[model samples]
Target: MHIFVKGAAIAFFSLAITACSSNPDDGFTGKESADVLYSDARTAMETGNFAKAARTLEQLDSRFPFGAYKDQVQLDLIYAYYKQDSTADALANIDKFLKLNPTHPDIDYVIYMRGLVNMQADSYFLHDLLNIDRTDRDPQNAQEAFKDFNRLLKSYPNSKYAPDAQKRMQFLKDRLASYSVKVAEYYIKIDAWSAAAVRGQTIVETFSDTPYVERALEIMVQAYGELGQNTLKQHALEVMKTNFPNNALVSQR
Candidate 1:
């Protein structure tokens, strides 16, 4: 009876130790279990099991909070969250990485990723600040995405990523120009001629390189005419003609 009790006690202790070393993967549990779990997570990610990969990475982070692979684990967790379409989690983890490693050589990569995450988060299906249905509209993600790309464009203009950033900026500019047009048209419908004029002129001045400027000038001409300001109207018309000689508005004149 004494030998049997000792054996039972030893078995209980072994099981307890194993439970404390819970495997993030399958049955492999120990300090070495971390390696196995990470390997499995990498395999999961490669197989496009992004959600499972994220969970595994989370487990690694929780289990080995101070391992040599902790930083890599954190990075993988961020990517896994991003791949799994968890924008909030991805952005939060990216922010945590930036705060903790501000001077890391890969800081720029993190900022670039932040921009990408925000771009994804600015979803058409997401609730807006105004509590209105935004399902039909493009999210403001493009604006934030531009800001992030511009950080790399401006601060590291000579960076290898600069050219791609410039292309992205142009895409952002087009969307922003479209947004201004929508706002200006809204003002026009409300008989807010002054506001429309301001918005139109801003597009003309700020986004002169875009085709939207042509449309903006047309709106400006209409706003001035509606307000019964012939001089301003004539000036706008002339400017439109001067800038865009073949402007359709000029042909109508």
Candidate 2:
């Protein structure tokens, strides 16, 4: 029975994909009416046939914009996309759902899923280490991922995902600060000392709470010295005295 059910799901998914990819102007009109499509799509989702559910939901959303099931279908479709790891599409539709039904009872689910997708995105280490030479690969994808998690933390501080979001946010904050230090190091090595100084200063000023503060201050000393601007260098030194008085590097200098 289980094997039969799986086989049926595979066949249903194949047909749904064909329906989604086929042009409306094609000769074969859809045999399943919108209501019937909705029923079948939901049945697919309940049975773990995510791809089939997504395809049918896509048809419902496009073909029945003004259909009575528009709102419900949109919500179900987002979940379908999420289950299929089409997270970008799921999130886009989530924004649409919020715009249409801001006061819906399940709004918290949207916020929770937003946090979940951000958490699922690739970590900074993979992007920073592996994509160093791949100019086509965006190094900023990590930043975008963290921003998404932070948004969830900020907006849904009390939601069920809040505790997990907060934990994820801290991890992001630490990694971002460390990555900034590496950028500063790169700039310092390439003789762009002032640029390096500013990047280090940003870590001190903006990410003062992060674990990277001491390292940034140490790098700032070298960056500012190489720039040969005593006045700006003095400012960087003062930041250490005021902000991180006990930072070991401060005394070493």
lDDT (tens digit, per residue) of candidate 1 on 1-253: 7567666766766875675455455543546578888898899899987767877778788888888778888788887877656787988898899899878776677777777677667653224322454433563777778888988777777766678778867876776787889889989999999999999999988888777988998999999999998898898899988989998889899
Local error of candidate 1 at 184, Å? Answer: 0.9
lDDT tens digits, residues 154-202, model 2?
7766777678767776776776787788888888779888888898889
Worst 10 residues of 2 by lDDT: 129-138
TM-score of each prediction: 0.77, 0.65
- State in Å the error of residue 219, model 2: 1.4
Best by TM-score: 1
Candidate 2 residues lying further than 4 Å off, grouped into runs, are 1-39, 115-139, 229-253
Name the TM-score of candidate 1.
0.77
Candidate 2 residue 69 C-alpha distance from true site, Å:
3.9
Measured with C-alpha atoms, the lDDT of residue 249 in candidate 1 is: 87
After superposition, candidate 1 runs with Cα above 4 Å error: 1-32, 123-139, 229-231
Task: Find the 10 residues in a row with the least total lDDT in model 1.
Answer: 124-133
